[model samples]
Target chain A: MERILAILVKDRSGVLTRVSGLFSRRGYNIQNIAVGRTVEPGVSRMTVTVDADPLTVEQIVKQLNKLIDVLKVSDLTDEPAVERELILVKVKAEPGRRSEIQQMADTFRAKIIDLSPDSMIIELTGSEQKLQAFLTMMQEFGIKEIACTGKISLLRGSKVTCDMKI
Target chain B: MRLTGAQMVLACLEAENVEVIFGFPGGAVLTLYDEIYKKGFKHILARHEQGAAHAADGYARASGKPGVVIATSGPGATNIVTGIATAYMDSVPLIAITGQVATPLIGSDAFQEADITGITLPITKNNYLVKDINELPFILKEAFHVANTGRKGPVLIDLPKDLQAQEGEFYYPETVEISSYKPVYEGHAGQIAKAADAIKKARRPLLYAGGGVISSGAHEELLQLSKMMSIPATLTMNGLGGVPYDYEYFLGMPGMHGTYAANNAINESDLLIAVGVRFDDRVTGKLEDFAPRAEIIHIDIDPAEIGKNISVQIPIVGDCKLVLKELLRRLQPVEKTNAKKWCANVLEWKTSKPLHYSQEPGDYLKPQFVIEEFYRLTEGNAIVATDVGQHQMWAVQYYRSQKPRTLISSGGLGTMGFGLPAAIGAQVAFPEKQVICFAGDGSFQMNSQELATAVHYNIPVKIAIINNKYLGMVRQWQELFYGSRYAHTSLDGSPDFVKLAEAYGAKGLRVAKAEETAATIKKALEIPGPVVIDFQVDPEENVLPMVPPGTSIVEMIGGE
Candidate 1:
């Protein structure tokens, strides 16, 4: 089973290592993770996707809560939430096939962010499935480089993970 | 008031009411040492950083106060790793202050530089690397708070050399409020009610206690609950003092080397009220078959520990004392004879297959006999710290601890070289109390240099070395299961411990026969200074009532 956890932590040095170190030490598998500052200063929110069974997911949440730097941990796997992942992909482009690549990018609502003499970088942000579909289409054209900001998520309604009492 | 970082550290310790520190001085900690020298702080210079850490841990275990230790950079910091992990595993409250290379040289691999905080991340409950002088006071105070708080464990604060010299305004915080670190102190009312109902329905209820009872000061509450409910009780090795060994229904330490009664009760119990326990594999052999018939209610301060190793029917995340008190309040007292049949059955097992060893006159002294004799001579009034190996198990079997913190041994980490330094720490904590370090020849030699520290401080700690000339625990396994191919288990040419003690300006004695064991211990007890006793025991003796690995507790192999 795949479970997503939204963790709020103090913005301090070594906080990342502490969080990741915990995952590795506990043998929890992290599928993907994205971290960035929240609305509050000196606080960061990390969205982590993990592959584990239901029991393991519960253990993961409890263990994450044990870290002193982590302020909050919410399993948004069963909650109604919005998730997105962004990818910057440079695809090999020739003069003849450029328009076809642009059409595919347009269909996926992606933008051609950077252009080179023989290649172009397309910026795309969407749910995991949409990103995967975009990548499959770009595979036809050689993907020269790829950078992904792993999935980041938030609850759909007024409910916020940080405000949820532990 | 304006104060240098070193002074600020002292201020925080003073604020926390730290009475003494176990530490060693080095180049990186020169500034802190200078402050200590000028300010006249109480410090015991240990021969090794590991000794200092264990000493601090022993002090903490004995005094119920978090112990403090200081070390220098690189090798010094790494030396305390085993000690830190030992405390972390046993849930001992300890604070380790390590001096790091100056901030400017931190990542450049400067002289004697090591990433102590990074290295200790997995071992420490929490740790900090002070990058700014202003954070020193708060970090030190927080280190103490975190170390002693719920599910107590070791916390480290790495101070850079330059920061220790930098002057800053010092204001120790009166309270710590880590948003991520709030501990639940009270169990849920509904859960307590449910547990009470379960207790009422249980005919063969058993109470299992662990180190948490000692850490939370819940021994009295645990005893009260057991008495009120007429329940049979068993203890983990770390929970030795949680219940007096002589209690009528108290089963001996339960695990691989557990007594016949303890293991049998755990196997047959209908309800297991496990408090302050983590269901360690040692305590729960072959987990799938452990207490198969029982419904377990686990109460611990740490939520993650509730169902960590074994499934729990009712999980309560709260202080053990508070939870036990609440359960006691909710349940009406049961009749004294409610579990008459069950209690009789347990007592029968206890008496039928009691712990025993046969040592004819003029035979090599049995380790068990020496411990039992010491226990009788001391009247079970002394605090006993033990080093790891077969001797540790033997002491655990024969020397029954009657009070919390009285049995100070490295339970979780099982680290060798813990006994002598730990006893020194305990002696330092209570100079008037009788503190004995029961060590093996192999274990004593690990941190044996600490006799110098003990002698210098006049800490009259007794060292009773069960000298078997081999790593008895490993040798036992080889003899039983490994075709008797004893690899490096032999301690072939270990130094004469008595000579080593005399060389360190401490008294020394040797007891090769069973007849001299009690007299030697009595004489050592009267020395009023540090003394070491080497008791030459049977080299191949094994701790019995043993449950082979991956087997059910009910299928124990020995002590029939």
Candidate 2:
């Protein structure tokens, strides 16, 4: 079981360490972490997704929120949220097959960032489900390399995290 | 008045209160050298750029600030790498400035060009290559900022030859905006409270301290908390002096070569409070058995350090300074002088062994006596750097570091060929303070090219070369348990150290008598420039209280 969490923390050295430390100590596999500044002064927003059951996620959220540098923390897995990930895929394509791969990429809505004589680099952005679908469709073109930014997320509704049910 | 990048080098240094520098000049950096002469600052010339870096490192550790070294491009720039890497591993703050080939020559691999910034990137906490003249001031400011802040480490600045020669106006800034560089200074209160509650409840509790306590200036806080809770203490190699060495509850060192009582105490403890230390392998022998029964309370400045090598029951991640202060605050109402019965047992252990070892007369020289005399002659005031080998072990075993930052060595890297140059940097960093290099005969040969650097700078550093006529440490291993099959351990064919020192224009001494040891060391320090004393003794002598490789704390040999 995997869950997403939103946390507001004061931007400081070792806060990420403390949060990640909590999960690791509990044997939780953290899949991704994205940190950025929030609208509130001195506050930074973080969305961390981890491969853990609801109880472990709840424990992590409770522990992270208790940190002096942490302003608030919540499990956003059940909430309406917009989640996205960016990926770069480089494929070893022959000159004869490059145009065919380009046509296939157009269907998946990925853009061609660079092209060499035998390689075509493509960039894609979407939810995990969408990425899986694109990867499955592009497998026919022979995927050679892949690198992804994990994920970054934001709440979908106008309601801030503080207004949601704790 | 506005100045050029070259001129600003000396100006910013002077502004930062840098009184002297240790470095070698070269062609690509001729402009930097030329600008150096424009103003009057003491610059010690070294034969090799490596010597300059060591001297700078030495000076920094002695003075408790960043040591500065300068070098030219390509070979000259690359030579100081060992010294920089040594500083990086030991967590010594040093500012290394190198001259690069012009910006255009970069990536083209022109004459005297090397990507020093790239080569040094991973080793340095932060590094910069000034391609634009306008960025020089900002770059320099950030270089110092990054060097001194958060876990203090070395920072390098590679100045392109064109940038050094360019006459663009320099405007040194007073500030920098690094949103990502902020370090957490406050400890989590809940964790502290929980740890304290655990400490108060623990009957067989242990408090372990490390170098981070000294770095964070939390020695007083540690003392206060320990005294308040009446906790027995153990110190890692870097953690010595976090509290008094003579305290009844103190376990001096706790692994491999740690005191018998300390290791035994750890094995028996029910709860352990580990603070300001990463459970390094040297401290925790065979992690599976280390503190097997004890529930661990780990307080660390870097959260990554907690449970890195050992599991933690209660984890507190915060700056040592901040966490210690919070602990002291919370334990304010508790009594400070309380004691328990375990304290009596530990005091007995401290006195019983105290590193008991003896030298049987043999062909190889004894390093222990040389270190003992080095400490005596200097009155424990000189800053010492050591190259890894038998001599390094002797230095640690025989000498006492009464204060923090007084002893600088390659703890993590265990790097050989570290002594001579690091001592030079130490001398240059603090010209007023004496620096000494405890080098093995074999290890010294590796970096002895810097002897020329010593003469050029005329730094009054003393080098005590323990000549055992063999790669003594390795030979000791071969002698002890390797069926006495000596391979390439013989160092007799190496360069004659006395002649080598004379060639570099420094005083050299070769003494075999124990009676002449103390007086000879005194004279070496009294003499001008750098001096190398080759102390020849029992080549067959071995460091005892030996914990054979991969063995646990319980398995100690030579105690019989």
Candidate 3:
């Protein structure tokens, strides 16, 4: 089973290594991970997608809680949350197919961020499924390169993960 | 108040009330050592950094205080890795302070520079690399806090050389609130009730206690629970001292080298109340087959440990002492009549196939005989520390420990050279108590240089070397499973331990005959300072009541 964990940790050097190192050391499979500073100072939020069974996920959360730098971890997989992934796909666009790529991007609500003589960089942000669909459609034009900002998520309601008392 | 980083380190130790430290000095830690030289602290200089780490670990286990060790950078930091891993595996609270290269030269690969924090991240509960002077005092305080709290383990502080010399304001935090590391102290009420209900309903209940009982100081409660419910108890290797050996319901150790009674009791048990123990592979041979007839109720402080190996019917995550107290409060005391038949059955198995070894008049000295003699002489009162291998198992079999922390050994990591240094640590913790290091010939020589440390400090920790002339445990395995083709198991080139002891300015004794074992140990105990006794026992002797690897605990050989 795939699960998403929203982990808030102390913003310090080697903190990321501590988190990622834990996954590698404990033999947990990380599908993807996205980390960035939160609104508050000295704190960062990491959205880690892991592939594990329910039992293993419970162990993963408990083990993550044991790390000193980690502040909070919430399994947002089953929770009502807004999840998104950003990917920049540089498609090899010919002059004749440029309009076709633009139309495809428009349909997926993606942006044609950059256009070159030989390639067009399309920026897409949506649920993992939407992004994959957009990439599948763009494959016909040949993808020159692709960069993904794994996954980031936030709860839907007033119940804030960071505000919960340990 | 403003203080040098080194001075602040001492101030924090003073605040923490750390009476003594085991450490080695090097170029990176010179600044800290200089402060030590000027403002004196009780320090024991171990010959090797690894010995210092193990000594600190021993001190912590014996005293229930977080042990502290100091080392320099690179090689020095690496030397203590094994010791740190040992403490980590057994959940012993230890504070290891290692001097790192100067801050500017940290990543440049300067002389003696190593990424100590990164190296120790996996093994340590938590570790820090102090790059800023301002974070020094708080980090030190946090290191101690993390090491001592929850599921205690080693915490390392990699102090950069420049930071140790750099001056900073010293304000040790009175309390630390690590949001990520708040350990649950009380078990859930519902779960506790469920556990109580299970216990009440059980006809043949067994209590499988582990090192957690000692760590949480819940041994008394454990024994009380067993007595109140008329239940029998079995201990793991680290849990030896959790209950008095003479306790009528004590079924002795359970697992690979466990007694026939303990293993069979578990096999026949209706319910098992597991306290403060991880179901390690050695304890649960062939996990699915373990406790086949029982419903397991596991209570551990660490939530991750529960259901890790064996699924439990009831799981309680809390401190063992508090949970047991709650459990005791909830359940009504039962009369012995309730489990009389079950108790009689267990007692029958215990008496029928008791741990025994034959020693004829002209036979060579048996290792078991030496341990039994030590037990008689010490009267189950001494703090006995042991190195790994066959001697360790025999000590577990023969030495009856009556109190928590009495039997200290490398239960998890099984580090070979742990005994001598650990004994030194235990002795340092209690100057008046009798401390003995029951080491094997292959094990003692690993950190034998620490004999100098013992002599210099006059730490009267008797070393009882069960010189079997072979790595007895491995040889036993080869003999059983590998066609008795002993490959490089001999310790033939081992130096003379007694002469080695004498050269280090310590008393030395040798006992080659069965009759001489007890007298020699008595003589060693009477000596004022550290004494090393080399007991030449039968080399072919093997630790029995064996459970071959990947087999069920009930499937045992030589158990009867």
Candidate 4:
């Protein structure tokens, strides 16, 4: 099963290394991860997706919480949360296939971010499933290059993950 | 007052009430050493960085204070890696300060430059690279705080050369406020109630105590709990002193080289109250077969350790002292009449296949006999440290440690060179107490250079080298599993340890015969300074009552 963990950690040097090192050392496979500064100063939030069983995922969260730099760890996998992933993909565009690709992008509500003589860059921001579907559809048009900002998530309502007192 | 970073380090140490530091000086830490010299804290110069680190660990284990060690950059920092890992494995509280190259030259490959924090990240509980001079005091405080609290492991502080020389305001915090690093000292009430209920209902309950009982000073609580419940208790190597060996409820250590009674009792237990013990492979020979009929309740300070190896039925995450006290408080004293049958059965097993060795007249000295003589002479009052090997097993088997913190050995890491330096540190911590190192010939040579350090400091430590002329443990393994092919386990050419001790200005003795063992040990004890005794025992002797690897604990051999 895939589990989503939201971790808030002290913004210090080598913290990322520590987290990643722990993942590798413990053999936890990280599917995707996104890290950014949180509202609290000197604190950063990381949303990591890992493929593991509930027992292993619980162990992972417990181990993460053990790190001194890590403040709080929440398993948001089963929570009511809004998850998003942003992807920019450059697709090959011939004179005839340009309208076809634009029509496909329009159906997915993606916008054209950049254009060149031979390629068109489409930008899409949505849930992981929608992005995966869009990428699958664009594969026939020849995906020249693709870049993705891995999944970042938040609770649906007023349940803030980082509001806990340290 | 404003002070240099080095001065702030000294101030932090003094504020922490650190009486002595084990260290080796180098170019990167010259300023810190100068400050230490000026401030005049007792510092013992170790021959090697590893020796210094192990000594610090020994001091911490023996004195219940965080041991401190200092070293220079690059090689010096790397040399302490084994010591740091050893402490980490055993959960010893240690503060290791290593010098780094100048801040500007940190990544420029300058002389003696090493990314020590990066190198030690996996081994240390926490570490810091102090780039800013002003953060030195806070970093030092945090280092001590992290090292001494919770699970208690080694913490490192990398002091760059330039930062040590830079000026900073010296304000030592009276209290460290690490919000995320709080350890749960109190067990949950519901969990404690559940454990007590299980204990009450259990017909064959066993208390499996580990190092945490000793580390938390919960020996009295453990004894009280055992007596109140009339529960039989078995100890791990680290938990040796948690209950006196003479205690009726006490079973000997349980594991690979454990007693037949302890192993059989564990095999037949119904409720296992495991406290502060991580079920290491040596303890549980075959995980599936271990305590098969028992419902296990694990109490540990580290939550990750619970259910890590064996499936724990009820997990309590708290300090052993606190949890045991709570359990004792919550439960009513039970009648021991119901447990009388179980105790009688355990006693039958104990007496049926007791730990025994034969020593005929005009025979060579047996290592077990030597340990027994030492125990009889010292009355089990000395702090005994052992290097990893058969001698260590013998020491654990024969020497009955009656007090907490009296037996300090490298149980987790099993480092060969740990005993001598650790003894030096223990002696330094408690100058009035007798400190003895039960070392093997193969293990003694690893850090034998520390003999000079002991002599120089006038540490009255005694080294009892069990000279079997082979890596006895490995030889035993080879003999059992590999058709007696000794391979490279033979120590054919080793130093003359007695002469070596004499060369370092210490008393030396050699006992080649069984009759001479008692007199030699007494003679060595009478020496006012460090003494080394070489006991040339039979090389073929092996630790008996062995559970062949991967077998159940009940499947022990050589007991009869």
Top candidate when judged by TM-score against the true structure:
1
TM-score of each model, in listed order:
0.98, 0.79, 0.97, 0.97
Provide all candidates' interface root-mean-square deviations. Answer: 1.8, 10.5, 1.5, 0.9
Give the interface RMSD of candidate 4.
0.9
| Model 4 C-alpha lDDT per residue in residues B1-560, reported as the tens digit of each score | 89998888888888999999999999999999999888788999999999999999999999999999999999999999999999999999999999999888889999988888998888899999998887888889899988988999999999999888899888899889998999999999999999999999998999999999998988999999999888899999999999998898888999899998889889999999999899999999998999999999999999989877888899999999999999999878877665778888988888888899988888778999999999999988999999999999999999988888989899998999999999999999999998999999999999999999999989999999999999999999999999999899999889899899999999889999999988888888888999999999988998998999999999988855
Ten residues in sequence with the least summed lDDT for candidate 3 chain B: B331-340
Clashes of each: 0, 20, 0, 0
Question: What is candidate 3's lDDT per residue for B1-560, written digit by digit as tens?
Answer: 98888998899999999999899999999999999888889999999999999999999999999999999999999999999999999999999999999888979999998888999999999998888889998998899999998999999999988888899888999998776778899999999999999999898999999999999999999999988898999999999878899999998899999999999999999999999999999999999899999999999999889887888999999999999999999999876565889999999999999888988778999999999999999888999999999999999899988889999999999999999999999999999999999999999989999999999999999999999999999999999999999999998889898889999999989999998887788888999999999999999988889999999999998998
TM-score of 3: 0.97
Q: Indicate the worst ten consecutive residues by lDDT in candidate 1 chain A.
A: A157-166
| Per-candidate local distance difference test | 0.92, 0.77, 0.93, 0.92
Candidate 3 scores a C-alpha RMSD against the true structure in Å of 1.6
Candidate 1 local lDDT, B1-57, one digit each (tens):
899999898888888889999999998999999999987999999999999999999
- In candidate 2, what are the lDDT values of residues A1-166, reduced to their tens digit? 7788888777755567666766775577888988888776667778888887665565566545434456677788888988899988888788898888888788879999999888888999999998888888768777889998878777787877753221
Compare the candidates by DockQ and give the number of the best one: 4
| lDDT of model 1, residue B293 | 89
**What does candidate 1's lDDT look like per residue over A14-127, in tens digits?**
999999999999999789989998888888999999999888888888888888998988899899999899999999999889999999999999999888889999999999
Better of 2 and 4 by lDDT: 4
Order of the predicted models by DockQ, top scorer first = 4, 3, 1, 2
Ranked candidates (lDDT, high to low)? 3, 4, 1, 2
Q: Distance (Å) between predicted and true CA of B222, model 3?
A: 1.6
- What C-alpha lDDT, on a 0 to 100 scale, does residue A82 get in candidate 3? 95
